[model samples]
Target: MNNTISSVCLPKTYTYDVEGQRVLVALTGNPFNYDPQTLYSLAARRNKKRGFLFVSKVLGKHVPVNPYVPLLAGINLGAHFIEKIHGVHQVDVQAVVEAVKKNEQTKEVYARVISQPRFVLPRETLFIGFAETATGLGHAVFSLFDNAHYLHTTRDKIPMLQPALDFNEVHSHAVNHLCYPENPELLKTSKTVVLIDDEITTGNTALNIIRAIHEQYAIKDYVVLSLLDWRTKDNRGNFRKMEELLCLKIRTLSLLEGEIDVSGSSYHEQSPQNLTTDTENRESFQVIVEEQLLNLQEVVSVFSVDVNGQESASPYLKVTGRFGLSSREDQDTLPLAREIGENLKPHRAGGKTLCLGTGEFMYFPMLISAFMGEGISYHATTRSPIYPFPKPGYGIQNAFTFPCPDDEGISYYVYNIPLNYYDELYVFLEREVSLERLQPMLRVFSQLGIPRLSLVIASPVSRKTEKR
Candidate 1:
């Protein structure tokens, strides 16, 4: 196999000029024999600190992908982790590559492979997924371990739940990440802690979190895993420095490893305005909100306190890993997803349907979409802003902006939804939202000419509060 950094097989260099700022990406490693183009595409981030974004094709974030694809990617990563750390080859990497190569037969491939019993780790492992982008990705990775605890960092400030640890993502649009594990013992008891993310650039975020966790829990072993690893020589040295300082073992792994260089002066780009308007066909679409499954006794609910110290019942499910989820609870979510999919499958108006998850609430929706039957694509709304360019080889072609349905104070975005691409749309939200708060998002769908829309609420109030 050719291991040259500037090989002609894959493009040696890629350059993207976004609004006068230039970013260049070079391939330094491709050990898995998968094409870089198949994994991710380059796009310009709207943030000044980080001007470029590697929008993953299989992540089910910026781009719509088969729900099983991301799951397979995670399983593949988990297989690699097992092989590297435990010297056990659990799953075939080539099979995963073949399944993800065309995005076809992925459901059968995933179902057949994932049905096998999970690999039991020798030691208890704590898996923490980064907030926003990698919430689902992290969960997917954690799912492959039979004996593991999972939690994803959150930007949401839930009152009364004191954060176990907080870290900063220096280049992220939302810098702060709060970890609110219901049981703090999960951090202290685990022998190995795995930090999962979609990508690792400078490795500072991992190091910073490690330092914070060591100050409190002080675990001996920590592994940082990502889909892409783009750390330079100097940036990687920081990890060594951190290990020496903290006196702990640190290991890094990724599907792809490479170096990146960004040049050219930064440009201040104005935020894209919400251009969605009420179209003539807006009345032609049907909006249905489903909450029957939420009423079931199996559904979990926790309370949240407001700034005034007034407590209100929260609809956020405990299975999301935001409050920490055990392996058994993680496995139980599969049946719940099937129940949801079965309930909503009859509502699908046509063969073409899209399931959209809101923000960090991604993995569940993608899981439901997988069981919803054929011709279903999954993606999510994100807080990260990317310059949308309608061209071949670009990750984001078109974009839609709207206020977060649950929190109107924060802006959320959905990308690459072409006009009339889907016959129906099922939007999955973690919390019950009023129709008034959902109007902006509904209008965006109306402009897209989606004839049918179903709001799949995981948690709803005992009484019906939303009206059309």
Candidate 2:
């Protein structure tokens, strides 16, 4: 007799009850294309080019993304534009909450979206959202598409993360290009694969993904959804071109229309000359994490971790440790988080000093903050933000932009800690570092107005000072 046990993983999405279930996508104001000043002061006069611009053969502003279009993104994403354009929105965030409430309007919108004469999604149909950008909207859509398997691509990299289908976004941060897709079968067998993103700029990103998926899974039909659609009537030609190119049909919907002005050639690189500098002093900075922020919901467990390696002081800062795992937690992440958390001590949360984590570094901080009592706020920046486009009275919902690192560029994420927002910060990394790279990163933070507070969670010890 063969012994068998059920798999701990989620079952195929084909088996779910969607008898009367509906999924809807709503837009607040018109769609604003993302072409904002990536490095602007919040209160600075709003640039006229801010907001999504529609550039097609019809509205031929066609230079590239930044050259023709200017948009405001981060501070508050597209929600900000909605508040500005339609007195109807409350800039503080309730509008997005209200818009997402899924009331009757939500039901009606879903009814239109899932317009199949019959009810219920077919078995094997999956919801595939883009990484970094559509992280939230994908989750929201998942809430409604309860019957669908919910998994979004992630830029986060653990020691070992595999990608189902890796693709590219011409305009995105370099570090986040590695997308770890959750469902490998997502490209295969699913009849309806929903491509969700915040906004559709050139529709290039979507086109790229669609092309990749076609080349891989070869799905015949795909649907593109967003809070706003900036594509003008002429942009439809590109859609037709892709349709002919891939022999697949891609349909899109949004609450309204907007446009993005283009100025430079598509290949023009917009790397900021001095955004992400790499030579800040390391030990000059220190970190204190707030403890009250441990154990983030429904995900990983939080625990106390001890350092594995001895600490030393030298021209370079050295810190290393193994993250202890709680019995209730998955053992895999323990060694990593704990090993790093210990040396980062004097841990405290809820204050000006921030312990910013790289993608999967989320758990380490959660655990580290457990030791760090009240003096910190724990949040990480996804490679996404709302940006101002050149169009009028419209906004782009979710597009991501990063400072070109070629010159010392800054990588802004959804959780942007504007320099004015915090006294100082200690950016934590999951990558290997030298004293030079780690130290200078700190000094740079100091220059930004606050003393730098940094910690080396997992770095090698140096010969200058053998013991801590």
Candidate 3:
């Protein structure tokens, strides 16, 4: 498809009244003259710390969008960054659109473009993607950089895994994020870094992480990549101050750079905090779990990790992030995604299918979802808990809660999906699963009247070796 960014809806003024404070959100910049509505819209956040949320239209989290949209958006941003890094001005929107087309026509073009970096990063540079939303975006961008290591922060901690760095996202419901690279040298050898996120509101989180990483390892160049740059005038100035303080060059890139004005009253508006059903009035919904129908596999692969002369075999396939994903695994992503799609087609013979990824395990599942044919929607279960208001103009209308497979105590949610919208649902997991972990979600789906549900398990390829 010859899709162009011109078709995107441009920004306009948005205003809302929240908790007695009058909030006004307006779009200020249209560098690409793209439609702001097509890119994002304004929604009031449930969190008191942040009143307004610039909900992305392309991100499949709060809303269901064509899988191609978010994937293409990230690729486009990568192209722009490449242009800037190489000092090539000719690689404009048209060039990016063409490149996307070429990529769609054949994987050869995509491979060629990604392998041959238009701009090279320092040999020691690391590409880190924020948890949840930007995990996929960062993966896409990381593929475009030559010889760069990739890792994404996570709220879920693996057993016996230690973080190389940990930081806080103040505005997020789950504030703390842990970064664990299998090889400590992945962070030790880093001299430059690119922080990827869905958007940059205050740039504070980026700054916070930068400071945390610098405290541990020296970094010289820092770049922030996002789908939208909504940093206020003061926020942009803060970056300059941070640069001087941190003694590093800080830059930002985005498909859209603009302002949002939030004006609303201080009158408190109560939104539904969590899914509640009146015990007396609630209808009895029966839920059933058919474990025999679920495609659960136990691959007895041997994974070795050597630390301090101790060698042990772990029954895990640790291909990528949390421990960090290498260049080889990055190269395998496309082919693996294609194989997954082919394997999933027979199972998708139902109307309005939904592909759901496990929390923090987003990028790979999203790619598989996008490739699973039309009338298919994609989103991942997230650790961030947002309130659902059953009203128009609200981003989250309905939410389904379930126990996270990795950590059963922590709750995860898939939002905006109504009970019967999708007749078929596919849940993708990056780790091995258990009947215990899958029961909660399966029961939720059964209650929602989803006719067919399948669990697809593809563990990451274990590339860990004993480092002499």
Candidate 4:
């Protein structure tokens, strides 16, 4: 319970536990705290694998010049910072590979899974990255696989979407994906195709996507990979049904799989004040640590902002004077945001801020986290339908409900942010959203606390930049 830290966007919880250590140490490289040998030993026991491996997002953060790493060279993985590449960013190969090797050690039956024969992949294959998340991931995976042809899903307003085949990520922030293979014959002509993503759960996402391609392009062979495979027994059964229904063979490979069971209300329900994996029948996805909070006072100050869906300005904004991640290569994004997060930490007095983004806009929240100093609780709000469950054993839940920043008049990601933890809050809105609509938006944020709520919209409503 003592390990929790606070920051903007992320949920507050303990820093790291036994499970977290295993998951995190892959990227963290914190040697002295727990023996690298022990994590290696622990990971060795789980040995699980799939023919193809897909890594979840590999997440990274820049910590203030810590006093400890200099003293301990093993901890000096790098100055850019130690990031855990799981579920948060593009699945990091180092972490996924290490964890896969570790898990293989404990479970001998699983060991052989990671030991599959290495095949010489084509120099380039058609690569499909899911929207938003797999944006960067698709390319990363493409880089690893030979002859990778790369394309990602997008929300860009197009005159006509010549989708080869389409599928609805019904449970996603928005059930919208459009694909126009550069070469209409690419999928049709290729004998093998590789799909990239951060995680592969029920295999529904993979199945539907694969089905779409197969139906439209008639690609017969496919490979699915993720950092973790938390597919339950039923989910696997349904996967087989989809395979039989489509009459195609699909193969999946992963670095790790959930050993502990998970089945509860919604995967996200517990408050920032009470995050405990100890609950019965509940398995939790984590950035780090576990905790049973003793008080709310530990929450220093909370800053909340609602991210707009537009792709301009920056992927994320900052209250503490730091810039976060930007999707496009803007000369303006990197230097400013990185500078702010790095310099702001030492000035802080151990307070917490909650930076909440609009539905489906997770990339911004993630960028903001990298800007924050240590002790920040990180989690973005999404519009996906999730049950408001706070007990253990819940695997999935809708995150939140919010209108689209675009003209579609839609709603997106709706989980992870609860208002009780904030003391001071901020909301980011575009200039076009009139004060009337903005009023209702502010009303939602008012629940956090009375603050000199600040807003930013550099461009006016009539001529703002186009959304990506």
Candidate 5:
């Protein structure tokens, strides 16, 4: 297949061939001045439901980007939301766009924009981020609003807490999404609800959640926000039908809007290589546990039981907005991140550092990495598997696969981490797990030649550790 690259302008078109599957993408709307290449790259998914995946460049999920890049993208999306609610002249959307563009060159401008006062929404709004991938992106967008309630859907089920809502992402590897709000009143009230995700492939996920929410809460207004909107005309008509059926309003916003055409037969799957086999000096790596940071927050007493009835609890701070957070509580994230970053600073070996966030725990670590000083890149482990192609312009050049530290039965992957590129690595986990389960991940780091490894756990539970 032939590939064509075009300038980042409206009505731009490009094609990608991933493992013999052909994907043609056309950008009919580029009002935000986003260069497609900088925003995302096309890669084939390992799943059969979705053949291709837009590995986001600014999402800090599949790619290790400067933390400022994803934050700027969130700021830009927030500004766009304000413009849609208030008049376009009300917010300086261009300023946010310029800051997003500046992130391509340097991150200095991000501080200036973040220091500016947040835009206070005219009314209370409930912002819901989809689980796994959009957890951090949703928080970034929610942080820009001074009057909003935030929560992200989760796949994990808390034993004591009953979910306020349940929905599904049909094409996702993990289909079920559960919403658990600490306060039930958060759903009953809140006139406006914003559904945030990284991309809108068909708009079905948004519609499904909207329908679910309306059936219970009957919220009148809904807004679906994403970095990319690829809904075709018929797919968009579904949203219109839903609005009419519910007698409500639905507005959609995105940095780029286009149609994606994917064709060709199924791609052959190859067995994953054992990347940890080269860990000859695994015992030589230093493992440090920063337990002093446990003072930041208390662990949720409720246990999350997996399929095997294995009970696990998250040791993370409540500020993740998982159990629902008000605008004031959301503001506390920065200070907490700063404090953790300061505590981790002295332990740094002063070379390139990589901050790795476990699944669904991205935004906080990204923010913490920003405060950890320069030469730092942030990304997270994901359940979504994509084909790794070691070529220029490919989104995932390499991958490290391991059993999830939280759940050994599940496979987790971290992509694009080049060997011998980083001097130190900090793996942040929301829950406290035994060293036995973490050995798989630690061994992968050992193979990468990262000499210093820090396991930053938010749980206050003390555990025995061996320091090399």
Candidate 6:
């Protein structure tokens, strides 16, 4: 079955009876403007704190999906947001609705954008994407904005980069997120800030980040951008109040909006639960995996910031659009991506391959993976820990555990890869690494029987650091 949002994987109205209450998620087409069923599939969450997970077919998380789907989702969403900002949202919304009525996928819908007039924001406008899930989506949206600056939150903190702001995602497997922009001035002078995430369940996480940033800097306006918005009526009211309390204007733009009903025997009022997991060793799959690992090829590449023709190495130098990226820096991305893709071409023999970014190091690998063609799927190693239940219809099927070198206390996970599916794997990182950090991931892939492997490590350099 095609797992994309435009496929028959979901229906207009989906009902689930869990934990005794009959819950319904309705995505009717006519009046509401967009189809929620076309955007997401409802699945059970492995975390008991949250009963249901709104599995996004386009977000490229939890599911193996085409890379273009999520990228187009962000670009279209960015176009919609620009229209809303310019007070011409009706035209854009109608165009999107028409595109959906024709059952268009991300690429087709993105083409409809030509029907709308161009909209631009100030050069100083800042775009921030939530980490792990929305990192690429957020960057894609920023790319559509011409020269706007972009940064995604990261749970990993680089020693060389000073922290600008920090916040918590209370219900997430990894709760803390730190922002360490290489150029501190990027956040200080912005008049409008656009916060992007894959989904907004309660609006609390957005509120937390907004509250934290508003405390440091006085912002004129804030835009909450997401592919899906499931915030309740009360949640909307609270956002309005937050706007008033912060003395700033707040707005939200999403492709789909509706209520999710999570009822029945599975529903429980959850306490603030800590993320804990019991590691499972898949001894049965070890032999085949070792054979594949032995046959795999490995390569490493590095990028350093140039200063007067001299290359200098620094951990947080901002090469991958981690902080804010402009058009000039972005120009280097395509060629580098093409180079990475060319290097992996000889290993392509028809089976599936995957490119993985370790934690917040996602956008660069995602971009490079796109150049590797259709067979290469993209995802990341995330700090979020979820229960791995290999049952049908669950969001998380299989998970590979690795120690988080960035944070020794917490373990990282890469999920949903079935055994023997991927023929090759490419791993990307931002820093020079030791073999200690790679062993777990290598062991996991070896166990899964993925024969070929490529490791790309790029170091970042900052203009600000060079100036000093």
Q: How much does each candidate deviate from the true structure in C-alpha RMSD?
A: 4.3, 17.5, 6.4, 15.1, 4.0, 7.3
What lDDT would each prediction earn against the true structure?
A: 0.80, 0.37, 0.65, 0.37, 0.80, 0.64
> Per-residue alpha-carbon lDDT of model 4 for 286-398, expressed as tens digits?
21111111111111121212333333222212211111111222223334435544544344333554433342233323333345554444333333232333333222211
> Candidate 2: which stretches are off by over 4 Å?
1-123, 150-163, 171-183, 244-247, 262-440, 446-468
The TM-score, computed over Cα atoms with residue i paired to residue i, of candidate 1 is: 0.91
Off by over 4 Å in 3: 1-12, 16-22, 89-92, 95-123, 265-320, 390-393, 460-468
- TM-score (C-alpha, index-matched) for candidate 3: 0.81
Best by TM-score: 5
Candidate 3 per-residue lDDT over residues 1-468, each given as its tens digit: 011122224445545543334555455555555555567654445566765566676666667665665566676777777676656542344644443433343233333444453445546668899987788778777766656788888765443666788889999877888887877898888777889999988888998998988888877788898888878999999989988987889888887776755545322255434442212333435532222121223322433332233333333334335567766556776666767786777666576988877777677777777667767777778766555556665566666677776556667777777765677778777655556756777767776656777777665334233221
**Better candidate number, 1 or 6, judged by lDDT:** 1
Please identify which of the two predictions, 3 or 5, would achieve the higher lDDT against the true structure.
5
What TM-score against the true fold does each predicted structure earn? Answer: 0.91, 0.45, 0.81, 0.47, 0.92, 0.78
Which digits, one per residue and each the tens of the lDDT, describe model 5 over residues 35-99?
A: 78878887766777876688898899999988878887887787788887676443456765765
Q: Could you tell me the lDDT of residue 294 within candidate 1? A: 57
**For residues 245-300, could you state the per-residue lDDT of candidate 2 as single tens digits?**
88888877543434423333211123223222232432333433211222122221
Indicate the residue-level lDDT of 325 in model 1: 91
Off by over 4 Å in 4: 1-122, 125-161, 170-176, 180-193, 196-202, 215-221, 227-249, 255-350, 390-402, 405-409, 412-414, 418-420, 423-435, 450-468
Mind giving the per-residue lDDT tens digits that candidate 1 earns over 1-468? 011235585536656665455666676666686777789877766676776688899899999988999988887778778889889877776788788877877887787767878889999999999989999999988888888999999988776677999999998988999998888788988899999999999998999899999999878799998999989999999999988988999998898887877776544454444332224444444544443335434334555543345444545777788989989878888788888788788877899999999999999898889999899999999998777778777777887888887667678899988877798888887877667878888877877877777887777755243311
Candidate 3, residue 29: Cα displacement in angstroms equals 3.2
Better of 3 and 6 by lDDT: 3
Distance from true location, Cα of 425 in model 1, Å:
0.3
Give the better candidate number (2 or 3) by lDDT: 3
Arranged by TM-score, best first: 5, 1, 3, 6, 4, 2
